[model samples]
Target: MAAFTASVIPIVSFILITLAVRCHATALIEGLYCGKKNCYDVLGINRDSDKQDIAKSYRRLARKYHPDVSKESDPEEKFREVANAYEILKDDESRRDYDYMLDHPEEFYGHYYRYYRRRMSPQVDVRVVIAGVITFVSIFQYMHGWWRYNDAMKYLLNEPKYRTMAVSKANELGLLSKIERRKRPKEDVKADEEAVLRKMLEENVDVRGGYSRPSLWDVMWVRVVLLPYTLVLYVIWWFKWQWTYFVMKQEYTEEDRHYLTRKALKLTTVQWESIGREKQSELIEKELWVNDNFQAYTNQQQEEMKAKYAESAKYRRYRRYMKNHKPGPIVDSD
Candidate 1:
């Protein structure tokens, strides 16, 4: 019983180790549904806040929480978060993406896919373990294949059919005396082809009686190594594509569209200024823009209106409500 228990322990340990590795790989691939950390709250600002306000908030937080300046336990972490939030809010395109993510939190699959695409990589430890495991296993498999090939050749030389062929090759290769002529039953004539090749190996000749042994490339190199590695990598890409499909298939609600439109309207100062006056008027007439800058007819008045809309009570109320509201788990449409 003790012997049996000892023998089973390693098998159980091996299975557990495999499960841990697979779970880690799957976690890296599937990623997490985003948590409800409001970026606006992180910066102590509202969504309607303009670039200047964002810059000001970021500078204040950086001064307060910088690891060098603050004695807080997680000053560096808070500093990093503040910096990230500022970077997003400072740019029009990135801010829009963030707004979209907040509005449609159920659509996190796409964001996670993009995040893992950029971030997920085999760490040094994982790579080292995988390399060591594959190397040892592959060497064992190769040696086993080599031994089996030799055993098969010895088996073949004893067969009546191969005895004549192998003996002739042995004589020609000056190994006839070294060859052990075995007279086994005729039933053993049906030996594996690899065993026939072994007779040539014994003769010290490169060719297996004029037929060559398969090169490493032609035989088990990929089967023992490349195939498993390729399968693991393919899992990541497969899960990514599956999640992308899930994200795209989700229907956009009216509220989602509204928030997206509002985000689109909040163009960067540079973006708004670069547009022609006629095009700006065209946008205003379409009612797609709600920026206070575009509320004015002239560029001079619009420039004065910058950063003022973000301070309004009504906009702040709306922004506050959106930040506080949390969506539930996403339901599968299918």
Candidate 2:
């Protein structure tokens, strides 16, 4: 039994490792453009279209699809695609990379890596690595905890003191006679003791009401020991695990593909408009316009709103005004 239990770990680990690698590869491949439309296709031109032709096509599409100018329900999204195509084709350096990616997609395995390395240093996504570590730890903890608990239970059941306590408790619960009926003539003492312990466990009452001998759970203090870890695990599971799993599943919708494309191009949402045109032009010149200070501006606006509302005279007065209006007495529904 011990050998069998020990063997299962390596087998399970191997399976998990294999699945993770496959899932990761699938996710990366999903992000790469495969048999999809290129920038030229987006601008209604051929790959060999010169700058003049590309500019003309882009301007026509931009005017037609611009959210502020168009009345279509989804014009903003179309405009985003057109703008991204224009940005790539307009730049000489980026255009070359884009064209290379289009022609040799198999060599462009690192879509996200290339995109990020251009703006920042080359490093693995800390979020993905952290999430993977947390997942592995959580699984190991669950399996190890259960194993320890079972081992502790088995040890307590064989101890003479616990067996006596369990027998006494079994009498109170009217299970002593059931255990007696199962006893065999000239049975091994250890086997007889184990049968009695089994009957006691079935009644869900630990030996000596768990005062003398701790139950499997109490012996490990699983809840107390795991509470903080559980909270952190929950946060990772909620925020990171869902997205990671979704990517690994390799089920790309049209919207998902578009979002990934935008990320590869370093485009934030229409929120870029908030950065003002002059700053936008400067960032574009530096190749930083796609995802420039848009998020910082948004965070700053949120903080300002919080401070404004919190310090407002109306809010202060409202708090004091509510003091005079106490909640009325409760009336029972029954």
Candidate 3:
């Protein structure tokens, strides 16, 4: 049984790695792009079309080929495509990628897949890894810290109020430092003292996604003390193992591709409108009637929004925690 468990993991990891490669990192782009050459390609606009001309062309085509009024054999299909095209040409990132593709048109299908993720992803991944490491190390450190806290805890334990107060202080310091998020619902935020604190503590509960163990424990067998170390080592192994597996199993299905294409198109439209607005804004600020700021501002806003959303998962978790935890503790001096 020990042999089986020992053999299973690496074997599974190997298989997962193979699968990741097969999937072609679909997470990067499986559902994050439109295939049209550019926003212009989507709307059937010519390369020579100016900004106004492009807009005019889009409006005209959108109206003439609208799915609602058109009765051609593939009218709806054609109209949808037209709409999809227009939407993409109108957005910033989609349009930019489309433009980049135009310039780097030689990029093979494989290279094109990278469009699914941004360069900042690596930084984010590193941050998360660092956070996990910090959490694990601190946990073990506290385990060792246990010896020192023995006396302090005994003193504080006699005063239930102090113990409770200490927990509250830990909770608050944890929050103020932004160590983690509150785990309460918005409705529960307004609740009484105990209820709120309880909710907040709930958020800090470590949510491990699979049967992931620690990383510090990776070592040759026969040592009981190494078992705990195995947990830490397991963490590091699991992460690399998971990454390798994911990379091996990366794949994008037809439907996933379709979703990405549609989303990219819509994003493109929003980007274009944003670009136009920034240009107009720039023109406003300038004594001269120039719209040079159009591109810069559009790019800036898209970047900002993308960044905000990129870290949104963490933000939401923290917000929930804050809303749940009560501010202070109730102490009874007996």
Candidate 4:
């Protein structure tokens, strides 16, 4: 008798729990979809309806409820409901989920899972979207780079110093001609002159830094495509670096020495190039290629900077202000 009572208690608890879960799932379904109406009912179809029947019903209902065709007060809202119902019922997986929800309303978690999964799923392929985005970004980057380069060229062409040099070079190359200028239209002549200037700038002017011309290889898509190759090269470089510095203790080549010197000066390739050839030659003459010499050079530069700053007008003004404002006892003039 005692054993039977214990078993009966568990069975009663199970039944109560099942009833509660079913009640919750039904409430959730009621809230999720078109109020108390089922998706099939929204599409005017039965549970046993086939895809063809479902599609047919959806098309009919959709057209009937369409805002343009219907004279109903809220055709737009009705159209949305019809479309939503059709969207769920049109897919086999979604339809199966809906059927399962109807059959086993006690499975509240499963119902929620299926509903969200369908809702959150993307309509387009993720890979295609990613590729499209990369392509667009690459194109924008390439165009922007060219725009900057052109702006730099235009600035150089307008500069008196660079223009003089460009004009001289263009004349030497037979690009600028008085006869051609006289014969051509004003617009044509101006275009020809600008073209000549640009050509000369391209050949003579070392347009470096951020204003350098764009390259296809520098684009985002190209960079992404070459990522694997870049990784391979990096690995090889790492091994080579380890071998050179640790195992072989190889002597630095001229290029390597120059690179080290630039590194010591904390200068990028663009910055080093902008410092001018004469200045570079002077730095090289100081034997900055050697670590000890580079350190000494750095110290000398710091001292020079300190001296220059001390001689500056701002520093002099600051010193004068500090001298006048020195902390001392205030004298009573009154």
- lDDT values for all models: 0.62, 0.63, 0.54, 0.84
Instruction: Report lDDT (Cα) of residue 38, candidate 3.
Output: 39
Tens digits of per-residue lDDT for model 1, 264-300: 5776444554566666555545444345543443465
Encode model 2's per-residue lDDT on 1-334: one tens digit a residue.
9999899999999999997666544432333332244667778988788899989999899999988889887998778778877886887766776666654445655555665455465346787786667666666666666666556667767778766777788677765454443355656555665666766754563323212233344323455567799899989867764675465765545444444444534666544444566755544433321344545545677999989978999987887877878778999999
Each model's backbone clash number:
2, 0, 49, 0
Residue pair clashes in candidate 1: 152-195, 153-195
TM-scores vs. true structure, each candidate: 0.25, 0.26, 0.25, 0.67
Deviation of model 2 at 282, angstroms: 65
Cα error, candidate 2, residue 169 (Å): 99
Q: Ten consecutive residues with minimal summed lDDT in candidate 1? A: 26-35
RMSD of 1: 39.5
